[model samples]
Target: MLIIFSIPWLVWRLLKTDYFAPLVVVQIVMGIVLGPGVLGHWFPAYYEFVFTPTVVHSLNGIAWWSVMLFVMIAGVELDLGKAWQHRRESGITAGLALGAPLLLGCGAAAVLLGFDGWMGPKAQTWQFVVGIGMACAVTALPILILLMEKLDILRQPLGQRILRYASLDDIAIWGVLALILMDWSRIGKQLAFLIAFVVLGLAFRRLMAWLDEADRWYVAPIWLALCGLGADWAGLHFMVGAFLAGAIMDGHWFNQEKLDLLRHHVLLVMMPVFFLSTGLRTNWAVGGTEVFAAAALLLVASVAGKLIGVRIAARVLHWAPGEASIIGWLLQTKALIMIIFANILLDKQVITSEAFTALLLMAVASTMLTVPMVEPQMRRSRALAGSAGQST
Candidate 1:
């Protein structure tokens, strides 16, 4: 753990990687570098010595709970009521933003289908395609929030608009994941879980309403654990349940400052283990060149698809010049959530480790590009707006 945390921290600070990648991005890169494909391949003895089966198992437990907490926080932070208030705008932008990448990514997945070592053994044609497609469409809302805060626009009108679009798409991403994970054999259990979720959700909400704000924090984790166990028992996966556990609750029940702090601390303390664990899962048995090629293809599909979608939204909304570029780049932030999505797919044997590795690379690259690309576009937009104000 110390080695995992210290290396990234030292590199991030010494090299000042945050101007482009941020500490989280650096940590992710460090994880990949430290994983089996890179470090383990180069130093099998050392890798085996450090990441022994027992140690890896312990790390996996920590990673699992960490990610569960993170995902729940993401669910709790969603402001769907605000999205509904501006339904037409939000719906159009969110739909386009999600749809375009999904289609392009499906096409990319189809291309990958022709290749060996990409599709998982259990995945159907449609499942692989749709799963990969949704992976492209996901926006890491937590990471997005972090980037926007760094860009000093978290509270701005423009930032809020972007959040609205992202929040809606976040819901779609999870819904699509659930669909992909649906096991017909366990359909009855899945249905039962849903019904129980709804019934119990009402009770949960009422209880939250009745509880003191300070007390709600303690109860929330109990809810998260129960939902996680129930969802896993039903074959939908525990992460899905963690998200649902959060989504059913109202954000207003907690103090915003404390919630934000919780999120920050989670990212700071726990998520590094998740990153490293995710990295440990990467496999290059398919060949490094092939993995890189697949990653490049997905990167183009993800980046181009997001820009095209947002540009279309800009045209329909008659947005100001350069606005689409800003929103598109910002929406393309894919670090955490996409990794989590791909992790789940890999967990379910819906995609191969090679595919997971490619997705991981694409996510890191996409996120790294976000701040560099959007910061300039935002500056240009501000200048244009200022010039127009002067003219008026």
Candidate 2:
């Protein structure tokens, strides 16, 4: 552990677009060895610490914490009151984000082919395809934060506007997922579950408001943790409940900044554990040609669909050409939700191991690609902003 940190952190200063990428890659490779793919296969007891049932539960906890922190931050960062003012453009971007990704996923599924074993068409192919497609969105929130910080556009009106609509875009994704899960067959009691969800959402908002008015940020996450258990008790996945609670608080009196501070610690501390743990589940060997070919199609379609949809939506919002373009490309950073949905589907057996492998590789590839494409725009936006400042 000490040796790993002593290995020169300064090296990552060069590739500034999400420094976590390379580190995550290294961890993932190590995980492949220590996980079921290698050590779990050959020396089960040697790698046993990594995936004991207890460790599995810990990993699950980390993932839920990572995402719940994300949602809490979403609630904190978005100026929900201001966002409602632009209901028109926000509506369109939300609509497009949901519609475009689903379409792209479906397209990817159509040309989809798979394999044998506990891997491929041994299960539900079409359902897998539809699930994958529906789950392929690259959310704009985190990517925008990173992009704006890099470009010095964090405080600009364009940035604020981007935040405005993109915040709603964040909310819309969850709402849509909740809607989809509401009807999902395995979920079984979808209607009763959904009704309970809405009720919980209302209660969550009130919970946030009370905490905020009382000036107690510490209590917020406790409330969230409780909500997780409550959701479980109500026969819905706790993560889904946590997400809805965040979405429900969008325009409420919650101190977004306060929650942000609280979640920062957890997000940094627990998230890597979650990622490595999740990465351990992936058996990269089983995902061969059929999966690769499908991933190829999915990647091309996702890039095109999101870039085109966002660009057009940006124009409708009256964004400058360059802002529109950068926003469009950067929004294709689709790592978090993509991985979550994939895990859910894979666990459900809707998608085979082959498709999961394909999706993981391609989604990571697209996310990595989005950063490079965004760097140029970051430079251009900064130079343009600087020149304008000097002229003024």
Top candidate by TM-score: 1
Off by over 4 Å in 1: none
Model 2: pairs clashing at backbone N, Cα or C within 3 Å: 76-256, 105-133
TM-score of each: 0.99, 0.79
Model 1 residue 153 CA deviation in Å: 1.1
Instruction: Write model 2 residue lDDT over 1-392, tens digit each, in one string.
Output: 22122222233344442543544333333434455656677887866864678867867766767777665555556677777787787778766755686688776676563334333433455555556666566464754565566566668776676677667766666655454444345465656666766776677666666664565356556756766666555544566666655555553454556554545565445555655665567664554465567677778877777777887777677766686667666666666556666666666466766676667666676766765777677788789979999999
Candidate number achieving the greatest lDDT relative to the actual structure: 1
lDDT of 1 at 241: 98
